[model samples]
Target: MARELTTLVTGGKFYEGPRWHDGQWWVSDFYRRSVFTVTTDGVETHQFDVDEQPSGMGWLPDGSLVVVSMKDRHLVRRAPDGTVGHYADLSSVAGGHVNDMVVDDRGRVYVGNFGFDLMGGAPMGPADLARVDPDGTITVVAEGLHFPNGSVITPDGSTLIVAETTGAGFVAFTITDDGSLVDRRVWASMGDVPDTTDVMEALGSGLPAPDGCTLDAEGHIWFADAVGARVARVAPGGEIVESVPMPDGLGAFACQLGGEDGRTLLICAAPDFFEHSRSVADEAVLLTMQVDVPHAGRP
Candidate 1:
């Protein structure tokens, strides 16, 4: 069945990193070079800007905001008083341009990367998951991931599940006390990993192509399918319990389950994604739908 979607915001160059916090939906407009918060009724207030373009967003235990500066490979920090500064320099450790991230209660951040020159259409390669300490130290948590994109942490902060786009599965890892990721295993395998270096070829090879994800109270994960144009509710071990197709066949890039009751699923949709085209167009939108289960775990 088609899930009803209500538009909360429109006219974006390209929307990514849909997050819910403090009674509003926060998202990054990749081409607009800015982040904004929107209420359920479509009211929007601009937050801050990132010249290099922003992708992922998370908050620290102190309530300060962290934004990913994709092109420059840096993490930008915004304090409660609205001051923005450099949080961490990831260029040296990140395998490629940084993408999405999830921060634990202790301010330990686990970040993903493109692993290749995605916008330039460079040959696809594996990437690394980096852990940025609260004190600004960088460490490679895991290496050789096939384009690790969206990620989430268990409620206890002991386990992490990351969506590997090219790998066609969700990868799991053990989070150590020192913030290192170990015990690498496949949480869910949708299909065999393709050997092609081309992104399109890998995505078209009958795989899930999972991207941004959110965890629910039942421990099921709702992940956006970048190539399938839908949001899939996946149980552990590769079971796709449900899939909510995007309205008008739009592509669902990222989703967050947040609201007063933590059941509102906000989805970021676009006609398509290509840095060159999205940078010059405004076809992205924010859509919302209520779900049965409330959200659980860290984003």
Candidate 2:
């Protein structure tokens, strides 16, 4: 069945890292360099700001907010009291800009990065997934990922799955007791990996480039198909069970399953993803659609 989408909010530069927490929809605006929360009825509020670009977000057990500072490669923490500080730095470990992350129940954050200078037109390269402990110790848990983007952990916190935007599929790993990722395997293979590392060439390959995503109760991953202009729900074996195409002229870049009943699928839609275009144009909007499966697992 086709799902109809409704506009939730507009006039944002670019939205990413969306999550449902504390009864509100929280998201990061990369070009706006700020984080905002939207109510179920579309009331938008500025939560805070990141001097550099902000991507993914998650909350700690103590109620502090952890956000990925993309440009500077740091995890910025905002305490419940509104005090902000640096939690961890990935400058020395991250190959390029740190992108998205997922925080486990123990507050261990798994983060990924771009393996090359994306905006500068450098060829794409493999990146590493790093785990940040509660004490701020950073360890490279997995390596050789092609543009690792959004990620999620199972409800039991025993497995981690990440989207390899350039690799054309999803990758999974078993999470050991100490938060180490092992048993690397392909969770879903959308298509063959592109031969070229050039961003444009890879995007033109017609493969499903999974971006920010969320897990549904039935263990299906709802991911934004970056170049497909749609958000697709895929089962574990790479079957595209369902898809929702973006409205005309808009491209889907990220999505999250959230709502009072966890049935609302929030999509981040924009005209294009070029930094020069998106950073200057406020053409991005957040759209929502109703889904049958409620959200599950750690974002």
Which prediction has the highest lDDT against the true structure?
Answer: 2
lDDT of 2 by residue, 1-299 (tens): 98999999999999999999989999999999999999989999998999899999999999999999999999999999999888999998899999999999999999999988999999888899999999889999999998999899989989899999998899999999999988999999988876887888998898999999999999999999999999999999799999888999999989998888999999999998889999999999999999999999987
lDDT of 1 by residue, 1-299 (tens): 56777888889988899898988889999999999999978898899999988999999999999999999999999999999999999998776789999999899989989999988878998898898998888888899999999999999989999999888889999988888888999999888876789988998887888889999989889999998999999999999998988877489999999999999999999988888878888889898988899999987
Q: What TM-score does candidate 2 reach?
A: 0.99
Off by over 4 Å in 1: none
Q: Score each candidate by Cα lDDT.
A: 0.90, 0.94
Q: Kindly report the root-mean-square deviation of model 1 from the true structure over all alpha carbons.
A: 1.0
Root-mean-square deviation per candidate: 1.0, 0.7
Clashes of 2: 0
Give candidate 1's error at residue 115 in angstroms: 0.6
Candidate 1: residue 224 Cα off by (Å):
0.8
